[model samples]
Target chain A: MTQVHYDKIALIGIGLIGSSLARMIRKAGLAGSITIASRSGHTLAAAKALDLGDHYTTDNAEAVRDADLVIVSVPVGASGQVAEDIAAALKPGSTVTDVGSTKASVIRQMQPHMPSHVQFIPGHPIAGTEQSGPEAGFAELFAGRWCILTPLPDADPDAVARLTRFWEACGSRVDQMDPEHHDMVLAIVSHLPHIIAYNIVGTADDLEMVTESEVIKYSASGFRDFTRLAASDPTMWRDVCLHNKDAILEMLARFSEDLASLQRMIRWGDGDKLFELFTRTRHVRRSIIEAGQDVAVPNFGRNVQAPTDSAKPD
Target chain B: MTQVHYDKIALIGIGLIGSSLARMIRKAGLAGSITIASRSGHTLAAAKALDLGDHYTTDNAEAVRDADLVIVSVPVGASGQVAEDIAAALKPGSTVTDVGSTKASVIRQMQPHMPSHVQFIPGHPIAGTEQSGPEAGFAELFAGRWCILTPLPDADPDAVARLTRFWEACGSRVDQMDPEHHDMVLAIVSHLPHIIAYNIVGTADDLEMVTESEVIKYSASGFRDFTRLAASDPTMWRDVCLHNKDAILEMLARFSEDLASLQRMIRWGDGDKLFELFTRTRHVRRSIIEAGQDVAVPNFGRNVQAPTDSAKPD
Candidate 1:
């Protein structure tokens, strides 16, 4: 199982996730050859400049021809078009999967176009930074992260096992879950936080009394943390909003309702209610740290930049 | 200017900020003697064990006796009580200030009780981590942080200058603002973020559809960023909400209104609006980095904890 290798691996998008996968495949020598393709010529040029794959092309079909594995890393909205583009070119018995955040939507978008001989397995690797594009990825992006697969009931077990070994070799732990459950889980953990972050940042920007300079100058207190997630890839997040509408909307509604109650508690001076909620939230952070999902560092241990003149003694 | 010194310094709360002040005074030899006091005996004992001050006391009045500088670092809700407790013992011509997050409330609670002979200037040092208590502080905690002072119009210029020198010795740049304006600025930059974090964490915890374990497992995607702020001391946050009520409520209302609009955009599938908002927020994060307020580390450069078995392959 450790010796599993793909004769050729075709990556359908050369953004952060796709480029990271290409780097990991090369680092582990898991693919005999790697082909990279992207819709943007500039991104394809960057991937080539980075020497990320054995073959690079703008044509999705050309990239997947004769490939044993095809991984679509585009926004979920683009998954259908890419699936249609590459379906005819996928070699017999090749396994097709994705690294989109929403698994159920990806399956729905891609499964119809897939050939009978090809296996389509939808997956999401629960890892990323706020950055995007080919230059933002690294070989270690998946190290110690989770790669969750939501395989169709009829997906060939042999193909699934082969892909599992591939992710494991890239230093990710693999798990299986139903696509619907994965969507719900991600909505709470991933989608809602980004939406909230974006909303709050937009609100801050629109405040007439509070100058943007003041917000930027004093952001270290707490606001800066939200800015990181709010600054995530807009195109990707927009696709996520469209593709996983039900779960995302459900989580958003719940989040807004909770916020209204909290606002009321504040308006009424209910210190006890506020304290109770704040105390309980600390446990979630502790559990995540214990679960090895995050490190227990103050401000994630970012090396703070030296104080500017304004923050220094005159 | 570097030769400025206090004959005696009293720290009237041995939590993270107060203990950090004690350490800085000791490290810089800025005070001939230091007294540390806390209502909680355990915290006072922790300060004593750490040798953070030359003296330790449970009596707030006793700690303030003959002190040339008295810095109250208690929760905002307790500022008035502490002022009342320490008023009689405050030495003539001594300076009394606070390190509370809310300036107007601190000034309101503390100013009336201060004798005319002693200068009562409200201050807030905008530096801290999620951790609390004496053991969580370090001498370097304020090395590159901002300390805002909201002095009364009648406050003596000499007294304000002396306290400014003290904060400089602690390695903080000091800025002066009106107490009300300070409260408003902090409401947008600090209090609202913490409130949002606590609210979301609470919502995720109370979810029936998603389990806490799943939230913890996938938190690295985005939820964990909020958790750090949510993990901050509950009592402190509770007091912040209660003391800075008007400003916090105003910010919360604005945040909620903006969120509702964002929710509508998502519901109506306005992908362009979503992308535009997300793209705009990125500029805030970039400005913060360029302003030397935060580093540009991706995901704050958290060292991935070595994967536990579940995140590792068999």
Candidate 2:
């Protein structure tokens, strides 16, 4: 039988990450009993319908009571409220962690409400699809992905080690880092990319010269890529923007500065400069593929299916 | 028999689009004989090895001799040179076309050099993967994709119809539009997206605070999407930037303006504004999927594989 890392586990926020963890934990037999909680009764019911956990509750505190490990998977902006709600109910010696995108902001929001007796660790899993909700998750969501944990300076070593084992059991490789460094790294890698995608999609939508229908029809050329990122959950991204403001802004500024130079190259017909930059960027994708962070196949392997002669018009 | 569209089809430039067309035409029996030409002997040899055509040559003019149709699929900057080279040898009444990303620039470059006896149509097939070269092509590359044709004002209707039929047989739906309008539409849908992607990837590469390894390791979070577009063929993209400068500059201005507003919203903590924009962009992705322009699955159907418990860490 698979080893149980936690006797009772509490999941706050039955959204994509939370529900995915529940499914993985159940499939791996990492927990004896699971309690799922969400502020929305609709979401909680969805989790129940999926048979994701042994218990479901609308009350965060009620769900966390007597739980040996608690995972708060709400948006970064909601971390403080969830932390406050479950602080009093957390079992002594229990481990409390989160799956937020921004580390520093989550730490700032949830650290104060964490009880002294419990071990508090802030984590961000670098894995997800653009989909959300409990129904959108699966057991393999975390497999081959990295889960980063940002523990407090004085946190208990045994508790951190136990949480690491729990994530590894769920099919993630864990890395520990400083909360500030995590935010900085993610701003350039995640936050800025999402913001740029949203901005580009919005720009295309608002163009009077080019109709929206044209954008959608010819999107496979390049614009379709941004749409995937832009389609990500708005509420979650809004919170990420609000909570990770500084790092996101810094990265945005850098991106704009670089864009201006690229614009100049285009205006001046500097093909050499454009080629140089374009060539350099290609190496990054190769390295990413080599690192096993992305599929090496072209078009993300979306074109693997054989094309029929009678295929419908795009 | 499928009814051949042309007795002899000459392909000038044996890169991604050129080679894909050769494969498709041969597969569908759309052409009785194929003549492939490339400026570089290396590329000509590659096409010969693939058996992509019935006849292969490094001389563009020789390839076009006695051909019923001539399709030039080189970078936009080289369109004029190819047109000049093949003009003397193009059979009278033969149809001529190109598959460049920009229509107006290609028209401006090739129209003057084209013989009055032959139809000169500027075309852009809104299809491709990041990978390029003669080897990175398949018969299905244009299946279910839109191919826009920008025929000249005085062009023969019979020639245009014949070209449309040819593309249809190769698995593309054809649309006709003004060259200027095509450039404007493509600037927003294709050119701007590539520029923005390249710029962002360059920005991430330049960041001192975030190491390159971190960016690559955590890229699946979002940055990897841009890398695909950014990793596209540099020479082709550079020529696109130079050829479609005016329209691209206009789109870039608008995108930068929108991004500035988005930055201010992030800086001022205007969550409602961010949410509004984010929500609006999601519908665009849905429309693109519904229109058959992109895959409807999350992450472009990249995560469909079952997550094995023994999977290597990403």
Candidate No. with top DockQ: 2
Task: Write one digit per residue (lDDT tens) for candidate 2, span A1-314.
Answer: 32337899999998989999999888877788999999999998889999999999899999999999999999888999999999998999899999999988888888899889999998888999999999988878888789999999999888888888888877778899999899999988899999999999999999888899899999989999999999999999999999889898889888899999999999999889999999999999999999888899999987776876554221
Local accuracy of candidate 2 as per-residue lDDT tens digits, B1-314: 23336899999998999999999888888788999999899999999999999999889999999999999999999999998899899899898999999988888888989988888877888899999999998889998899999988898887888788788877888999999999999999999999999999999999888889889889989999999999999999999999999999999999999999999999999999999999999999999999988888888887776776643221
Candidate 1 local lDDT, A65-181, one digit each (tens)? 999989899989999999999989889888998999998888888899998989998989888999999999877778878889999999888889988888888788789999999
For candidate 2 chain A, which ten residues in a row score worst on lDDT?
A305-314
Which candidate achieves the best TM-score against the true structure? 2
TM-score of chain B of 2: 0.97
User: Per-prediction fnat values?
Assistant: 0.68, 0.77
The candidate that achieves the highest lDDT relative to the unseen native structure: 2
- Candidate 1, residue A41: Cα displacement in angstroms equals 1.6
DockQ of 1: 0.57
